[model samples]
Target: MSQRRQLPMPRPRELLTNSSHFFAFGFGSGFAPKAPGTVGTLVAIPVYWLIADWSLPLYALWLVVTFALGVYWCERSSKALGLHDHPGIVWDEMVGYWLTMLLAPPGWQWMLAGFVLFRLFDIAKPWPVSLADRKIHGGLGIMIDDILAAVYAWLAMQLLAYFFVG
Candidate 1:
């Protein structure tokens, strides 16, 4: 059997000194010993709440800006950490969950649904998501898979809203 290589985890001091690492780590939520991705996604919730009332155009624009910035943040952090797509680099998860919440209904239940769905797709990595994760490299590589997963989750969220919230 082949041995699996373990990726290095950054220390808290690194986060304090590096802006890119701080953001890429989801405001330090990625430092969690267990399920850093989940913790990062949770960090997105309050962010979503802060902007939940924005107009659609504004919300979409914010996603575009953040997504672009995330690419750079992840790339720089990955380089600094001497790893590719380190588990602690979770800016992708934050952006993915926000994408999944696009046009989501206003309610705690809907938010929770979006959260669960985003996490499901992110973790499952079905089809193109898995393909991207395996084939792509660099910061875009790290973010692309999660974005694809978010698309899947977004589609599921729309379907669920249509069928149940009608």
Candidate 2:
């Protein structure tokens, strides 16, 4: 049996006090005892709801900004934690989920599907995602795989939306 080694836990005080840590941890959702990535993505749902109605251009702008900043914060947090791609560094998850929902037809059903597909692709790390995860390093490494997973999930959701909901 393969056992995953846990990353050292960051204290709530440190996470809350440091802006980089706060964002890297997904506004504290990464503090969850289990599945911090899932929690972080879950935390993104409400934020998505708030902005889902915005024009596509605006949403794309937000995504770009978040991702560009993520590279920095993820790197900082990973350095502080002394772990690369720490499970607790889940800003990638939050952004990835948002990317998955971009331009998606509005509905609770589509949201749920996007969530599931995003988590699946993120965890599964198929093909290019796996390659990026294994070969890349630092914050870009951490964020790229999830972004690719988001792409996969987005495409899958689009297909499913077309076939099942069209």
Candidate 3:
């Protein structure tokens, strides 16, 4: 019997050099096999918690910096990997989730809602979100849906917080 040849396993990491690279790989959360976007979004929670006390403006600053830079890094990493919007690319999840978390109660209940809502909008890509997903390409495509999802989640949170909490 002839011996079978085995292919080497692919490394989990995609080398990230700059802000774009970091966002492209979901800050390396893309390496996870299962629930990559969720994992990537989850990874962002602690960072959010750390800056939990900072002014909203500060967080906003960070968000802008990442969003502006991500357009290029995400595209580069996705192209290099030979896949467009690969599951491994979860940087969009991280930023999107963070944006969703913004303006929420920050408690378990609200945070959990935010998480679910963000995921749903992200996966479904309703309305303009779908447009962004299909019409856009490269990093913009990878991140735009998540951005819309975040916007949806944030608005939903506002409504919920007002009606449910008050």
Candidate 4:
């Protein structure tokens, strides 16, 4: 019988030399000692603020560009880290958080709610999100589940806004 091969763990030194590391780590947010995904998502808040005033089409363009870049670098980082869906690779979290906030109303309250909801659905991984997490591989594998989680969060945020803010 053939044995399954194991991927090697990513090293801190790779962060110094690898461009992918810069993104995969969410510009170092992934280096946090605990809850790196949460930290990465937090880091995305300022980025969201920067684009909040942009036209909807422009904002969407940026999202598409960043998501494409994320797909490439995240894949490279995964290969470098040698671990599929490594905890430290948090670009997905950053992108996912942005997606969660894309249609949310402007306010600290909405932002906080988006953050909490995104984190909840991301960690909980219900339905299609869980399915993608388990079945997909490579860059798409890393990003899809978070995207699904973002979708769930976005829907919840919209409902909350309808009832509470609208």
Better of 2 and 3 by TM-score: 2
lDDT of 4 at 85: 78
Compute each candidate's TM-score over C-alphas: 0.94, 0.94, 0.84, 0.90
Error of 2 at 17 (Å): 1.6
| Candidates sorted on TM-score, descending | 1, 2, 4, 3
Arrange candidates by lDDT, highest first: which order? Answer: 1, 2, 4, 3
Q: Please, what are the lDDT tens digits per residue for candidate 1 over residues 57-121?
A: 99999999999999999999999889899888999999999999999889989889999999999
List where candidate 2 sits over 4 angstroms from the true fold: 1-6
**Local distance difference test scores for all models:** 0.93, 0.92, 0.76, 0.85
The residue-by-residue lDDT of candidate 2 on 1-166, one tens digit each, is 2133456767889987898999999999988777989999999999999999999899999999999999999999999889898888999999999999998888898889889999999999999999999999998998999999999999998898788868
* lDDT by residue (tens digit), candidate 3, 45-89: 777777656688988888887777777777887777666777777
136-164 per-residue lDDT for model 4 (tens digits)? 99888988899999999989988998998
Candidate 4 lowest-lDDT run of ten: 1-10
CA shift of 162, model 1, Å: 0.9
